[model samples]
Target: MPFAGFYAAAPFAWRVSHLASDFAMAWFKGWSQKDQRRSRTVLLSGVAGLAFIGVTMKRVPPGHVGLIEDWRGQLLPGMYDDSGTHWVLPIVQHPVSVRVYPVKKKLVKEFTTKDGKPVEVMLQMKMAPKIYYVPEIYLRFGRDYGRSFLEQEGAIDVNSVVSQHTFDELVGDNADTEDIVDEIVSRIEDAAFFHKIKLRDPNIVFRDPNADDDEGP
Candidate 1:
């Protein structure tokens, strides 16, 4: 979750307001009652403005990008807010933060090898959505785009690739499983690219499904 800018700015606003109030009291001490009340009202209005600004602005943290969406669930085009504080309408517009940093996800699939042995294969991948395509990504997959699209498509590709190789070819000393992993990664990368996700450094490990608790990916 992204932190709202108001929380960090509120304290500063509070201190400024306090200083202004103290100064106002000192300055209005010798003034007429009517004039003092009017001046105090102005001070209070300034404080209220500060509070409103604090509440309306949101912070987009490092390694993340922000999108603006309207109250009617429609994304505003070309409204990308980068890493910084941005002002957005409280009710009419909403700011959405999407992580651009790579996140690690592990996919485990069970399938039969070409030699008919049941095996479990685990694929580990690091991926992140492209910052520029965040709006489109959010529209298609919501916030959980990785799990919704990448993982689903990756699992299908992994199953398809792993089932083509025999158990010996998968686990043999001279086996070129790197090529297999590369193939699966390529396919997944291509699929994820269409959804604006960048897949990186994917690895796969195969293990016997009937074995007793072999647990390292």
Candidate 2:
């Protein structure tokens, strides 16, 4: 009888142990589901936030051109007091480049050579916008003039460069026509003083000449 009771108690203990394990496993599964749901929600929210930020960045669209940098190192639409990227009211402003130019010029003018003979002079100068002159040049000439700062100015830009004294200065054989031109250029540069243009080295090509016939004026 005691042996029979022992066998019967073994089955009872096994059933209780199995039931306890089942209950623990079910509770564990419930907890896991809650944590998984929370993690998924957090991940989705992060993705959405990143997407929103990317869209905003793309939408920034460049604003009104507070300043523009040209190929010649000149700024257009006018020069700026400061340099680097700038910010402005949205839709109120933006920047754009309208013109770009190389660093070279061809000029023609009439003047008295050293011998007091009237002659036509031609010049070819290789230049670029001075890093310093952009602001003033843009303000005065606007973007168009700033684009080809020399072109817009042209020869007439220095209307009085060849002064009455220019002829006299060349008459005494003390100064050559080229030297006089240099003086005129110096004065023009001094007067305008636009920082945008660089009057680098100049090459003189005598385009044409009318002999004085060796006759005294």
Candidate 3:
């Protein structure tokens, strides 16, 4: 098979063909026996290089950012790659992808109202890391930022707002549901902002705890 054909069989064959062509001329060169052996060595080394690139090269899909980290778990700052192909060093470095698009998260918590009533609250929100702060976000919160920061911190704010309202102000026919949801979202947005996450249109649903009670109303 042609040398290009050999490269064509590699995992990222289509992508690596241009790379293989750069060194392939060595195989067709006129040389003495010793020089031919040297050429073979160089050609083999080129193949190895191509393989290394195939293994280390990473492609960050659309709407995502990629970061590089070493085996020691250290991230290289200011070197994040936007959507496209990039090379991560072999063996010593690997790729970490963080989605830049909004991610929807649902949080359920039981909170005690000012009237001491237990209300099951379901909060749903869409959030995404600020593009410029993605590296810092990963550094501080790691890849699971949604769970580590958003959910944990957001829950606190949610409960705080819920605890301030009486059961009638939160869930009954007299409930000011819109105002309460707005307050919860406002508090969560503040928390999310400090953590470098952008929150959008957070919503809440309340289920009456007494609805499931065996006793008749």
Candidate 4:
């Protein structure tokens, strides 16, 4: 009779054990889902915080102009001058530095003068973009106006002017090289004025063709 009673209770005991196991598994699954949600929220919040900081802070150095370009690489209309610190959207916009201070460049070229003699002339000049026309300069020349416009175009103008004068007229005993320099400076200043560039205080030197030379003026 005792053995019979034990067999009858075994099935009931197995059902109770199975129910308890299912309850435990369901509770654990619910707790895991909650943890996953909390982790995701924290990760998204961190990314958003970083993006906000990046957009709010910007710096522009002294003696420079800050030009802003959009993500599509288009320059904005506004110009920033004499800057120390600035603010803009970091990812959507970028800051470009343009030096407003006077920039110097030297040009040395061999030209055949009106008398057919090859003369080497060296010239130096100081130039800068007008403050009020910074935006125009940026629009017309981009970031390399100093080299592309001033140096390259200036060289061509210098050669054209020198070709009109003979070697004797450039450096002879009665030659006033200063007058030539002044003329060249005036022409450059006039040409660049429309483009928002200023040329100042040009100085010219004539190098001896017989001397050993390796570089320009």
Candidate 5:
């Protein structure tokens, strides 16, 4: 009968079904491996691109100078100017900023005049580090040169110069205060020159010696 042949064909149909299922699984496994390789390649390329950008880019602000230091902690020879972007070696070198604009420093101190009279003086001066000597300045005073060197040494010079002058010379209308100011400025200038500082206009205000308060009215 035709119904008896159906059972005979069942074994052959089962073999064909099993073969198709095995082939499908093999194709899926190969496709997954290819996708994994592609993903790994993309990840590595992105990391390399970011690392390249980090090493080659630098920015210096306006009215400033950039100093480059190598991995050995030695400053580079050339001075970088202000307000521009620059390129430097990543991880091998770094940049430091030094202000090129004038920096104002003030000193208020009490000193004895030539006549043995005690006087109070308030002095203000503007100065900046020389562009060429900035690296040396950094090496010596770091980034705080204004407080570390300028204010400290400038006060000492001012006190020294004021001690040599009479009280009347500073406050008397007939006396030439400009000469006294010039002398003080010159001495500070000489001291600062070695430290890479350049001096600008200096202003002085004298307080009444008899006043009890430090900031005399």
Candidate 6:
């Protein structure tokens, strides 16, 4: 078999299935000693390049919200790959999973009433990469946003959005707290801009904000 064929075959074996892992140690060694080391070097170099590219740089999508990282599953936020190549080499597979924890949030808070009363306001923030943007979310945020949850200082910002309106709007019986939260979500949707997130109309209460059911309706 040609040397190319050998390299090709080396990546796939019936027993192990992933021959690339088997040859992972001396992956660069060529089939024939007579072959010029230069070609080996070049092929190895190409392999290295493709290996890195194969591991990274998902070629899936855009407008997503997630975390990104190098091979180690480290976190890299607000990052993107410049380019990617489609190599004829089978040493690596296409559609390799780009490590990505899809972006999502559930808002939970204790709202202080005008009388300085604390009311627990639990919100469910449903934000995910709009299908088309899942891969982009991974590329942008890395595997774990790159490390667990992001710093959602948006509370302050969300408060700002809340502050713009009246107390009645937020905690009003007629208005409903969930509707108020939905409004807050809309503000976030616009503020985030390129961030792909979905905000459902917030419901009135997570688990009955009423102090107790004993109170008459």
Question: Which stretches in model 6 have alpha-carbon errors above 4 Å?
Answer: 1-68, 71-105, 113-115, 130-154, 163-169, 175-182, 198-217
**What residue runs in model 3 are displaced by over 4 Å at the alpha carbon?**
1-36, 79-83, 209-217
Residue 75 of model 3: what lDDT?
84
* Candidate 4 lDDT tens digits, 1-217: 8599889999999999899778756645756777857765886799788888767666677888988888998878777766456667777888888888998866776767778887777767787888878877877777767666755667777777888787887767645777887787777777787688887777777665745665566
lDDT by candidate, in order shown: 0.81, 0.51, 0.81, 0.76, 0.79, 0.48
Off by over 4 Å in 2: 1-91, 97-102, 108-121, 130-133, 144-148, 151-154, 157-175, 192-196, 204-206, 209-217
Task: After the best TM-score superposition of candidate 6, give how far the Cα of residue 23 lies from its true spot, in angstroms.
Answer: 24
lDDT of 4 at 164: 79
Query: Candidate 3's residue-wise lDDT over 64-107, tens digit each?
Result: 88889899999887554564688788788889999889988788
* lDDT tens per residue, model 1, 93-197: 988887789988787768788888887888887889888888898898887777766557887887788788898777666459778878987888889978889
Please identify which of the two predictions, 2 or 3, would achieve the higher TM-score against the true structure: 3
Q: By lDDT, is 1 or 5 better?
A: 1
Ranking by lDDT: 1, 3, 5, 4, 2, 6
Compose the digit string of candidate 6's lDDT tens values, residues 96-196: 33323344455566555545445555544444445445565555654433222222533544555554545555555654666666666666557444555
**Candidate with best TM-score:** 3
Better candidate by lDDT, 2 or 5: 5
At residue 207, what lDDT does model 4 achieve? Answer: 60
Model 6 lDDT, residue 33, Cα: 56
Worst 10 residues of 4 by lDDT: 207-216
Evaluated at residue 74, the lDDT of candidate 5 is 91
Candidate with maximal lDDT:
1
Per-residue lDDT of 58-118 in model 2, one digit per residue for the tens?
A: 1212221235444554443553332244433233343433222335567666755444446
lDDT of 5 by residue, 141-215 (tens): 777676667457877877787788788887677367888877877887788887878877878777666766655
Better of 2 and 4 by lDDT: 4
What TM-score, over all chains together, does every model reach?
0.71, 0.38, 0.73, 0.67, 0.64, 0.38
Candidate 1 worst ten-residue window by lDDT? 76-85
Per-model C-alpha RMSD: 5.9, 22.5, 6.8, 18.3, 18.4, 11.1
Off by over 4 Å in 5: 1-31, 70-74, 83-94, 112-118, 166-176, 209-217
